[model samples]
Target: MIKTKRLLLRRVRKEDWKAIQRIWKDETVSPYAQYDNIKELDDLSVTNRIARWGREAEYYNHIFFAVCLQDEIIGYISCNRCVDAYEIGYCFHSKYHGQGYAKESVLGVIAYLLIKIQMEKIFILMVEYLNYSLDGRGKCMKIEHVAMYVNDMEKARDFFVKYLDGKSNDGYHNVKTDFRSYFISFDDGARLEIMNKPDMADDEKALNRTGLIHIAFSVGSKERVDELTHSLSADGFEVVSGPRTTGDGYYESCIIAIEGNQIEITI
Candidate 1:
């Protein structure tokens, strides 16, 4: 069992099915549940489902837990094996909303997964309409720039400026170590910093390696993606993939940059 100052999280028991059904029946909580417009389950159905959840011994497949406070069940959280990653979902009674109980219970479950079960790479599926106020500090924050090193800075700068319409600043030159850089700003505030060691002994492009696989840019629509892909192909840039819907629901096309780096243009 995982205990916080005001909450306790433990394995869901058969007796807790009534509280679980109550939470699922709540209209407010039902909408945010794993399944949309989920129908309310009866005592027997809930019991069967609870039995199907199995135990920590069968955690290789799935697991579910009840979130409680003062011996009263308030909500439930679950983690299911999704291919290679664990996908987690949580639902709380509407009356308990805005109390940070969900966060505490999730953290406790994560601790159990990592420390006891020794599981890694948990994926939290979020609602599409929700925006995360990540730090809870009421401060606006965003990605300023993504930086990378290239063999040919001028060629890379020209490719982005000419094709991607990225505005370039006066290139920066450092004499101490002969490092050089250029900042390419897009229509949005986001910028890309391309840098290189001008006087380095070894200058070879690293492709199909471990770090920094690709950089993706979101376009206006699918039409824009097609247009950009055609333009890049016509300009002799390698179009690796098509302007098609990806398995992850992205309408995108992949192209190789001047320095052999993969760039994804998506809608």
Candidate 2:
């Protein structure tokens, strides 16, 4: 256990799962986490997680420390030994953010690793500011998927698959409400959920709508952008804007696709 001015850093116990669950469920915290199965966490899974942490600590010297403030677990820090240094990752309850608790706890862990454990170096992993590895090698917070209501789910699914090169699932249907949906996945691990339901409102989308104006996709280069813009235009999709560089220097084009929704293709 390590103590700071107002916090306690200790080895996590099985009972700490509830506190950890609350942290994981926080909207501000979970999306940035690499725990794709967080929503499925329960007694069994959390207990197994704790047990796995124990095994990791024992077998590989990897450590997970629960951060406590005033006798309450508010966050955790994980230190995993990389090839040459320890990579540190952490998450705190959103309520405790900007309180310097994270800094203090990280300092405590760094001290323990460097002095007590006699480690050579430490690296702090920042998920928010970096493109995180998706090969199960590191933690990152990115848009898992975006869901949108569409009139024709299959048409939307085919549009993404044919033009955007998205691979879609078999699709899902609910017998009770006549609801259906498809999960379209892209090469970079991003996803789009197109859903449909009976009697869903088909509101006329205005030009200057307030909420969620568009979804932008990066196609890697100006040539690809031009090719896709021309392809989409050939397919009768209205080109709303240019394949020319914008004032901000984005080589892109805007189009009306997927049920009148705006899609931006950029380099």
Per-candidate TM-score against the hidden true structure: 0.47, 0.50
Q: What lDDT is reached at residue 39 by model 2?
A: 46
Give the per-residue lDDT of model 1 (tens digit) for 218-255.
65456668999999999898888888887866678899
Clashes of 2: 1
**Top lDDT hit:** 2
Off by over 4 Å in 2: 1-140
The TM-score measured for candidate 1 stands at: 0.47
Which ranges of candidate 1 are over 4 A from the true structure?
1-141, 199-208
